[model samples]
Target chain A: GESVGLHLPTLSVQEGDNSIINCAYSNSASDYFIWYKQESGKGPQFIIDIRSNMDKRQGQRVTVLLNKTVKHLSLQIAATQPGDSAVYFCAEKTAGGFKTIFGAGTRLFVKA
Target chain B: DVKVTQSSRYLVKRTGEKVFLECVQDMDHENMFWYRQDPGLGLRLIYFSYDVKMKEKGDIPEGYSVSREKKERFSLILESASTNQTSMYLCASSSDRGSGNEKLFFGSGTQLSVL
Candidate 1:
């Protein structure tokens, strides 16, 4: 379950269930995509990243899918846990430039 | 691996008092940035420096200034703190070596409260 906030979206999921968070990027020319996770009192940590040339990339327990056609990016988490509850955001960067554009981010809440 | 350290986790200052926030990175990254995060605004870049002595203003630079006198340190200065300026400040750094080096490492952030 997910609720839209005034500025950020909230996603609620049960423990042991799979979760998918979606983001619609603004730039079609962006070549790199990244997913970051920020906890309650910590800075954002790198979760996973996918290049434009590739369609999907998988980490230990997370997967990132990139769709250049629609400028959409998604992060899939398997077997959601309480530790996985955090704010997830999408970021994009062009190949020739260093500036990265970030999405508004979605807050994931895990219900045990 | 890439550690960006901020001097303070929480700060309280009086209005009209000059405040300085220090950030240090050990990665020797060429690009360093300062951003402010709010409830609705997300992360807004305040200033960025691509070199030791060079800097560029980001989206919200009013009432804020930056100094990058050293390669590993970047400081954000508020000449006169205001109540409206109270927010979470984040410092980030990235490498300018070449393509595929655009991942930004961020500090834990400093929550500033101005009264």
Candidate 2:
């Protein structure tokens, strides 16, 4: 019954603008979070991750924000590009386990 | 680059037939996982192996069995394939405990259809 879910199913943003995708998780004890980018017909690729001890972590052009208090997670992309269009997934590492639970992905469509 | 390869890119099977999904990892990761990706359900783990000949049941392991005779190979077996079993199967590998949040490397996936 415990699940990780996203606030939106789809998001449309301009190529030059910024985009924010939100996720809500039911498990509070999850210590690690990761954001994955999955293109059509391709496997999920690691984007960025943030540990419970850290509130936020940044990658190439993306940032992952974790809020353990609200069991919320978010991914922010700066200056979204056309290549950034894909399904974004937020995964939570099971406490004391190597398994991770992924949320219903949010499809990001960046328009040029 | 870490590469996880699935045996098939696409497969179709008849209901009640046996199905075998093979996954092989080039990396020497100790952990190998089998997952099925479905819309709205995201990715649900079917099984995982932390060592050769050792396995663990995942969230949705029903209707599925796994084998890990070798460290570089993991297999998912569907005793009797059903229409509900049709979905994209993804194979992933990761390091064992204490490897630190090492990300899971996924295979291209096999799209299976049971009719």
Q: Best candidate, DockQ-wise?
A: 2
lDDT of 1 by residue, B1-115 (tens): 8899999999999999999999999999999999898875557789999899999998789999999999999999999999999999999999967785478899999999999
For residues B1-115, what per-residue lDDT tens digits would candidate 2 score against the true structure? 9999999999999999999999999989999999999998799999988899999999999999999999999999999999999999999999857634767899999999999
Model 2 stretches with alpha carbons more than 4 Å out: none
C-alpha positional error of residue B47 in candidate 2 after TM-score superposition, expressed in Å:
0.7
A1-112, model 1: which lDDT tens digit per residue? 1111123388999999999999887666778888889899887788999999999999988999987887778999999999999988787777867566667778999999
DockQ for all models: 0.49, 0.62
**Worst-scoring 10-residue span by lDDT in model 1 chain A:** A1-10
Best by TM-score: 2
> Can you give the lDDT of residue B64 in candidate 1?
99
Clashing pairs in 2: none
Residue B95 of model 1 has an lDDT of 91
The segments of candidate 1 whose C-alpha lies over 4 angstroms from its true place after superposition are: A1-8
Q: Residue-wise lDDT of candidate 2 within A8-94, one digit each (tens)?
A: 999999999999999999987778888999999899998988888999888888988888889999999999999999999999885
Evaluate residue B37 in candidate 1 and report its C-alpha lDDT on the 0 to 100 scale.
83
The per-model lDDT (C-alpha) reads: 0.87, 0.92
